[model samples]
Target chain A: MSASDPAGAAAGAPAVAIEQLRKSYGPITALDGASISVDTGEIFGLVGPNGAGKTTLIKAICGILKPDSGSVSVLGLDAARERHAVRRRLGYMPQTPALYEDLSPRENLVFFGRGFRTSGLSDRIRDVLEFVELWERRDDPLHNFSGGMKQRASLACALLRDPELLILDEPTAGVDPTLKQNFWRRFRELKERGRTIFVTTNMMDEALHCDRVAVIRAGSVLITETPEAIRARGRTRVTLGLRDGSLREQEVLAYEEEMPRLLAAYGLSDEVARISVRRPSLEDVVLGMIAGDAGAGEKPAHGGAHGGAHGGRTTGAHPGAGADAEDGGNV
Target chain B: MFSNINAIAVRINRQFLRDRRFLGLSLIVPVLLMLLLKYVLDSLPGLARLGVHISDYAILVAAYLVHFLAYVLSTIVLVRDRKDGTLGRMFVYGYRRREIVLGYVGGYSTIAAVQTALVLILTKYLFDINLAPDLIAVVLTMLALAVVSVGLGVFISNFARNEGQVFPFIPLVIVPTALLSGIAIPIDELPRVLQWCSYLIPLRYAVSVLDGVLNQHRSFFSELGPFLTLVAVGAGLLATASLTLRERE
Candidate 1:
């Protein structure tokens, strides 16, 4: 279900619920009235470009940041007021690899586990290291590990507490594709074990693995929908390669009706060397939404011209409407 | 809270153990300085004439060296933790700010204890420096100086953005405090205005307490004023450091 679905809200309290969180660094508003909800036992992806407030939102939800206004609740506890209790149930891995360069993976786990007051830490450390496939080299200092290995080690630290809600920021940014695939597999495995995952990433491909994705830009959430729903908003594009090494593209909402017309218009002529239909991906939908939002003159909600002293007015666009129209052209 | 402090302390100690060069340097600098002082004093004609025995200066120098080393080590480690996101990571893990500060204290204080003991033993055997009849008082005084150093280090670390920024603090904070705290010259020999300024430097109280214990053979209770002042200043600096700690901008 979408974050805004009333039925989902009625079913039970979400694992995380942020309402109009506003935070600013002088003139730069990091989070401008940002809001979203993540259901329990679901993997929620916050997809955004750099400076899109994804990290800020994650920090607020994790109780690392105190919003200037509004409220944040994690597992029905106020994140800002009841921070210690909320933090106990949440595991957070920051965007940067936060492991000590001189310490081994096991040592890092031991430190974090003790900080979280976890028991049977030695066994848990071994299990997490093995899960991340770093068991063989867990004894080596983190400085000797490759970027992917460091990322995996950081993930192991986050999992040391066996938290019910895991918040990971760009967990696979520098990781190899194979390791990224493995990380996703592990995330899915954790989900099956009744855990809720909130992850942030700029990679559109990564969002496909999440149960729901929130498209954030300019410190505002553009839309929240399932991967399939977001893809549905994207239209199929027909591209024709010409002999002159140039290409002509037409986006079609109804492939059956528009495909015939476009083919007939172009005909089986020598000028058109090849014609292919390309289905829209999540990238297209997200880009289309951002373009549409920009065209609509939506000021950056966080830390832009309208973000600071004046205070941003809530400008909630109809979620997914502009994206659907922009993607399908005539849907 | 204790568990969190212990865990962080263990992690910090492990990091120190892994960097053997730093550990070695921290332990050896004071000994080298003490040896250098011995040779210099033996050659100088005015030391005996001035009634300034090398033994009297040895305890003072040892106290100052231990304080300086503790300050440098704690500042570097804390600033590195800040720059590298370790401090932020611990904050995310639900560690209170005071606990993290205490963890640094616990870790560095352990090293300080070792360094103090080694310096005391080395001064006695290697330097042939005469010790006070009450060795425990001398040890307690040096440990207090170490605490002051750790507090000052952690406090100064908050102002430093990176490791490079930490260097300027040596000249601006350490050098002036070392010179003014009567480590090199007695406070009575300083200019009247400078003597007044030394009161503001916490190390002055530490040196005073050490002198009282080592040179005078005074018990801890006899040097209560300076001892309490040293402890108070260290506690004040640590409190400020904890209050200023923040995870992010």
Candidate 2:
């Protein structure tokens, strides 16, 4: 139940549970039985490359796109069957800052805030505006604002309802690193307040901000794991500085065990003056999983990646295996 | 639902107000068009001599102006909304298709009222017209046409993918309206087929109502048949718009 718990699996249904989703557009299938589970009060990331079904998955969860099969349950209610109920309980921020650019940030917030009967909406507007740090320029029209400012305003609108779950699609795609960091900061704040966030981001680095991330590619999820766990699966790179001034580099897996063996070879030898171990980044781990899944035909195309994968699974192959898919079949 | 609709309406109003150029132009264009109608009718003093009431033609022209402006503006604006994802955003924010449609109509209704009044006032002053005794009714009819035009605009916008796509529809609607709404020429003078087609045009009802009030000297209340037809067409178009509008992003 604490904020540190990524699963948030304490006495409540998972915040979002999507199962066996299959969506297609003509020759392209955006989601091929992609199943993902996000626990309550957690920040979940759906990471992938462009045209990786990330947007489709987000839309299905929001009940904006009816899945051809399977189910999307938000706060335990069927997303399609009870869309209005699910909609009332969740706030969605699309990839682009979908707002009236002519209106000021404050005006946008007020307009969106009116949809929900928030108690003391004016106070709530002030709070969200200040939270997004757009209160000072509240009346300045949005078109005049930079990309980052518009994003902050969009975030303010999405946060206005104070819904139990917030679904964001590429909330930080085009913003600068500082703004991206700022958005994540606000997301964490919302999570700390016991709100569940389901974020779809194509940027692998952004995945580091999520408590748990699901790596998807070509309408299929390849793996779901914490950033740390994914990174651990990546082989560490070891560099050795020898007395002869000749350097040696090696990719070592299970470095905890390999490091000792590697150092022992140089033990009692002045030839090995120094050593450096470069751990794999979370991005490498995730991209490896996505690429590995494409190579491993062993994984069924329709099979959902529901916590059932590792960073690398291509030791077994049918390289470039799954049916070719690109993201747009939005009905 | 009411709250959501109200919010959308208020937001639309705010956005419309900010675009002072469009707002000012939409209101002024109808009045300006009315003045042009006056000059054209005056130049046809021979028509008045031919036992034709030129004032009646002026009001029909005014009605056509109201419909054209409301239709064009609503279509272009809604197409932008759809293209820019505003409508889709509203859908994700829990607003229903019907609510969005009604909200948009409600939003434009206020502006249409102002436009309608402006055009009617100027039409009254610029030419010899008999809308004064029933000025309220005349305004209501014009406002009703504009609202229906808004609904029809929204409905047409659903078929368009972008603002450019919205223009092709203009000729589709305006041509039939001009030829079949009994405006440019009397429906009865046309072929029997085109006359039957006039009944299908919403503008025909508005034109019929105006003609009755101005030439036939029928009181606004007595022209209930065409007046109610106009209202019914508006309801149908609004409903059709709600149905056609995308429920998914």
Candidate 3:
């Protein structure tokens, strides 16, 4: 956010850059030419429904899966060719628990800490456990932990190294709302410290917390832009109530220039008893893209060469260039 | 690499110690089986004309039983870790395949050592077997067998899909190999083909080395060939295991 901005720290090298990544299993294509770039110190969110290839993309970036034909570079190093080096700079929290239920949280941290060869491991573990608010239950075996507690412990494992980039896959799934809020706060704090975070979530509301969001569906990223840009893809809806108990709703562009003309056209400028205007949420924006893609009968070349080229150097892009907001259905 | 291996080894040891059922199975079950064998052999009416010493047979059987136990324990632990994604998580954390394999070997080898010592001590005092003068040779032979068992367990775990798959391997691998290793009869006394097949079994060398020290009173130097063969087989199996291990199936 300032002179120490991670985006400016390395002018040319993006924190994560993927181009034309494709992966498959037999006949099922898990990822189809998905490409995106996450800038340094940015909280980039991958928002999509289940089976949208969010996990696949995260795995490819973490070097856990080798893409069939693509290039993935983390911190300017090839992820597949230089896996260990890339992994050393990353902390990944998998979708599943992927933990030793038999071992205590403290023991789990010790095991993973040694794998990363972390220095001052004890202090780091304690710090992360406290940060996740799991320090009091650190000695309990993970089997005894609730779903959210297990998730926090898993996050603590990734945080032990204080990595330069953290890749989390659905970190807030099944987590209580309070803990979910805490996680976002911690992510923001990490961003302030110049660490980048790449996270995936199906919860549309969660996208608001990220600096940028990539809307993916069925293995293809539909659009990648800032949260504000995504929200702007939906028009503001105005609800009008008449004196006779009749109700009518209308959609208008977000700009104020259209408001008065629309009100006059409805002949409700003086007769309207009540009026309310609300903008579309992220869910609306994603649903609009999905519906548009379905109607076009052709997949929007989301994050292709142009998207990739633009995404590489810029943090904010106009929503019109990607998905047309006027085409988005009524809010 | 060394530190990662050491950490994994320590973690594995703690897991084994915490699992009371596994501890009992690995340590107590074999001794109990040895006791049952001792009683059964003692009950049999055998004269001096037969020239079969029940105590010597007890030592051989005890060694084989303990060796097989080590195999089962190590395979179950390794396979469980793989199935649960713990090993995969470690890989994502930058731990290499060989480090994980070596960690397993180092950890289970500790269990093997304790197992060998416990079984030998229990059999020696419980059955009053005359094993004092050549105790070190016998212990060395058992320790060698333990190493081979650990290696075999880790290698076999790669082929198993789950814990249930591991059980079938015992009859297919351990039982046949133990039978051919002359646990019941001399390999040379079998037919020529069977005798030749015994050469392929590492346990044959282990049984031979143990027999020489405990029954034949041979020096460790005299049985050095079989001992070295055990160590070499262990190294080979471990290398293969490490190469076969993958993050996913």
Candidate 4:
């Protein structure tokens, strides 16, 4: 991360800026004033559990759904007012498979190409099809395509215009492991071409490859940080990974107060790695915070102007947010 | 707006052309239904008494074929895309909701016009029904009726969620509209409220327009009012359908 890197400047350029985005369906608050920014060419990930408002936020940005309050700007244009311009610059791959099953992949590409107002369309079509490795099956009816193949064609259609920003919602869901790896590799290739990608996912390992990420849950974004920073939340949790059957009883005893010194006395530090007592993962961090609040029958021990702003929970302002390692629990 | 409209037009055309079975049905189904109606009506004594005039039957055939094709196919196509996610993707791709509605209506109207023309020609030459009021008024009426039927199709598409749900609306909309339009029934003999419905149904004017063109000594304007009515109904339905496009399914 160079301080003034070109990519950094682009990432900081505010290709997409959301300020206090709020949406609701009667009583269900879909987006509770969530705010995030993406740089011009960075691949930013929005990872969260189900019903976390990722889809709602994406829909609002795409101009499919109207936000109740707050603002969304894409590439310096307001999404609601300049929807056409925003659509021209952005390519969206919806979570569901949206292609016409009766049409061949080539036909589908041609239709979408004409929609994007692209030139040299046939050549571009062949190029994108080849790029996605779906050229071999271009003539097959989409109804005949397997899930992975359909997804590839869907992506090919989205890339027809060489869009500046790509918003893919769970692009690899249900894809096999090998194809999933290929998909991520293709995403990296796209990033190298100076394209900004905004993706939503729940898989944490993939988050490691993202330049930055926002971990959201239940319509609220919990944290936004790099994978390294998130993992560094505490000293780093070390798992014992003990000899399978041999550790069950010991694992139960390790939770006991007297066992820490006893395990140290065993001289098993090499085989038995010490648990550094770190905060759980981004996923676990969110679940744990919510769980702790539920158990304590109180708020997250954090409440201030910024602490609970926009219906989101933030760390307390007093005592320096409790050393930044207090696991966000009042207990 | 026009580019987005053109995009949807191209998609609808490509979609119809790609499916051989659907294309065949689009071309053949209405003609077959016209022939089936002729046979069903000939068996009844009352319709048989309209002088057994080949020309009257031919005009009715032309009207029904145009009405059926416009109403049935448009609803099916629109509802199918809505059920799938293609409509949603199109919205994301810079297509204004109004363009989508207009595009489909325009495309379907074009197909219905061509098909109606062929049916009229077949009835005139092959079935020996005379063309009395020239080709121009007949063409105008067919086009108006087609637009009206397509409008009804667009309106119904908004309410259908899936293919299975779509077929039921066909009877609910098409049957009553067809029956009340005076295509299969005589409007004068019906009750007063039923007569008012005939005014509401665009096909009533369609049938009237056809009867005027085919029946000798009956001035086309005597039925000109119906032709104008069909056009007005179509425009009204189309406007309402366009407004509904702004809503998400």
Q: TM per model?
A: 0.82, 0.83, 0.81, 0.77
Q: Please list the C-alpha lDDT of all candidates, in the order they appear.
A: 0.78, 0.77, 0.77, 0.71
Error of 3 at A72 (Å): 1.7
True-vs-predicted CA distance for residue A171, candidate 2, Å: 1.2
What's the true lDDT of residue A85 in model 4?
74
lDDT of 2 by residue, B1-249 (tens): 898888888888988889898888877787777877778778876897889877777788888888988899889989998888777777767678888899988898888878877877787778767576777778878989988999999999988989998989999999999999988888889999888888889999999888888778888888999999999999999999988887764
**What interface root-mean-square deviation (Å) does model 1 yield?**
1.6
lDDT tens per residue, model 3, A160-179 = 78888999999989886557
DockQ of each: 0.60, 0.66, 0.56, 0.53
A1-331: candidate 1 lDDT, tens digit per residue: 0011211222578989988888998899888888899999899999988889998998888787868998998888888888888878878888888889898998888888877677787888888898888999989999999999999999998887788899999998888655765787788878777788999998766675688999988888889998656765667676878889999898876443455567776564445433332233333334336556432223221231112111111211222212222222111
Better of 3 and 4 by lDDT: 3
Candidate 2 lDDT by residue in tens digits, A119-138: 67787788788888999999
What global local distance difference test value does model 2 have? 0.77
Displacement of residue B214 (Cα, Å) in model 3 is: 1.7
List candidate 2 stretches off by more than 4 Å: A1-12, A236-249, A255-260, A263-331, B39-53
Give the per-residue lDDT digits (tens) of candidate 4, residues A95-187.
877888878888887776666677788888888899889898898889898998889898888787777788898888777645765676777
Give the better candidate number (3 or 4) by DockQ: 3
lDDT per residue as tens, model 1, B1-249? 898888888888888899999889877887788778677877897878988767777777778778888998899889988888788788878789999989999999999989999888878986575665767777777888888888889988988989999999977777778789987889999999999999888889878877777777777788889888888888898899889877545
What RMSD does model 3 have? 8.7
By the lDDT metric, which is better: model 1 or model 4?
1
Which CAPRI tier for candidate 4? medium
Please give the distance, in angstroms, between residue B232's alpha carbon in candidate 4 and its true position after superposition: 3.4
Question: Chain A TM-score for model 2, please?
Answer: 0.77
